[model samples]
Target: MTTTLITGANKGLGRETARRLIAAGHTVYVGSRDPEKGRRTAEELGARHVLVDVTDEDSVAAAAATIAAAHDGVLDVLVNNAGIEGRTADNGIVAPADETVDTLRPLFETNVFGTLRVTHAFLPLLNRSAAPVIVNVASGLASMALITDPEAPAGFYPGIAYPASKTAVNMLTVQYAKAFPNIRVNSVEPGFTKTDLNGNSGVQTVEEGAEIIVRMALLGPDGPTGGFFDAQGPVPW
Candidate 1:
């Protein structure tokens, strides 16, 4: 059975993805910042639990060490699903430029830098697998072309910090995929889902949001790497 670890699996899209992967027979580790929440979510979903705070190096290392001990140091998939939607009053349009920067800084700490930290820590474990896969959970709003396009979906829901941070994540996915040819790395743009981030305004459900992520996580060795895809297909950079 493939061993997969998903960060921020206590709730939102992360939790939903974990549930789905468990059903598919993968040994999944539910990662969360809080031990109680992590353990509880894992128990609820019948999966293992690991405490992982992506923003902290010590926490991420500890989580990786735990996974190494459990699965004989072979990690099949690492889903960088933990992210934050910074304070965006009025969708951030009315906020000042400095406010945008201030808001985005926190989001980046988790969304962008946090992902790098976790990926770096677990890379050794991932390398042990015959076919390693890393899935970065991005958003359609991250697409510069789509966000800038008048007809694109992201153009309608404008949130500077959340959307821009996801853009960085999408780019990071490509760079990592190129860096690690043996590991199949891909970024997925989940369309607007009714997660806690969007104030539950999205039309899609969390199960729907996690579909692309779970699919990318389960890709075969021959699957496309260094690519960005939405639910339907390829997304413009």
Candidate 2:
């Protein structure tokens, strides 16, 4: 059976993804920063739970160790779905350029460093699986093509820290996929979904947003890797 773990599974796209994967016959670990919330959500979905705070190294390591011990060090899939939008104030006025570094620190710590920390710690367990897969939940905001195009809707948004972190995530996905030829690693843009991340002010629903993530998470051995994709198809970096 496929054993999968999803970060930030307590709510939003992460919870939705976990629900879908469980229906697909995978043993999913609903990973959340809050143990109580994680357990509740996992129980509701009939899945398991793992307490994890992505930004915390020791927490991530412990979660990995727990999963490793229970599953005999074999994790079939990992969804790096945890991320933060930072203090964008509803995507309004851009923060002063001088404050860029300070603002970006926490965002990068969660979106970029957190993903790496989890992926790195879980590599051993993932490597042991017959069919290993890694899905980094990126965003359309991370796309240079979409964000830079004058006519694109993303042009209206003044956020920097969030998108930049996702851009870094895309790069990390590429590098990890290249390094692990035996595993399928890829990034997926879930589109503008109505979730807490955006205060439910998006164009799509959580189901719609989770569609691409679930697709990439369940890719076959022959499926594409090291690519940025959306529900429609490839997204230009």
Candidate 3:
């Protein structure tokens, strides 16, 4: 069977993706930091649970070992979905001028470094699969072209840290795809979905947001790699 692992699968887009992948006959592992919540969500979605706090190196390593032991050291797909917005109390993005090293560190810890930690730990297992896939859950805000275009909605976003971290994720996707020619590694834009990350302010639902993620996670060996895509199509770098 196709074995898949999704980080932050306890809720939101991650949970929905796990449910859909399970329904599609994948042996899905719901990766979360909380054991109780993870177990509950996995049970509800008919998936297995793996404890993973992407920001913690020991936690990520342990989770990888656990899944490796359970799945015979083979993981077909990995969805790096864990992230944070780092918005203020009023749900306001941090202004570019106010963005300092201290202000941006936390967001980078989880969204950028955490993604690399998990992907690095699971590389061995993913490599063992006949067709390995890596899906980095990026955002439209990470698009340089979209954010620079005067007419684009993302151009108006005031946040610097969050988008910068996701931009790093897109770079990671590109480098990983180049490093591992056999594995289909790509980043995806979920399209401003309603979730806790935005206090449910997004225009679309979780179902709509997970469309590109699910589509990319199910890519075959011959599928496109090293690209940033959304539900509509390829997103500009």
Flag the better candidate by TM-score, 1 or 2: 2
Residue runs of model 2 more than 4 Å from their true location after superposition = 88-93, 96-98
lDDT of 1 by residue, 116-208 (tens): 999999999999999999999988888888889888777785457778789999888999988999999999988889877766777898988
Highest TM-score model number = 3
User: How many residue pairs clash in all the candidates, one count each?
Assistant: 0, 0, 0
User: Best to worst by lDDT, what's the order?
Assistant: 3, 2, 1
In model 2, what are the clashing residue pairs, if there are any? none
lDDT tens digits, residues 84-175, model 3?
A: 99988998888989899998999999999999999999999999999999999999999999999889999988889998999999999999
- Candidate with top lDDT is 3
Q: RMSD to native for every prediction?
A: 1.6, 1.4, 0.7
10 residues in a row with least lDDT, candidate 2: 90-99
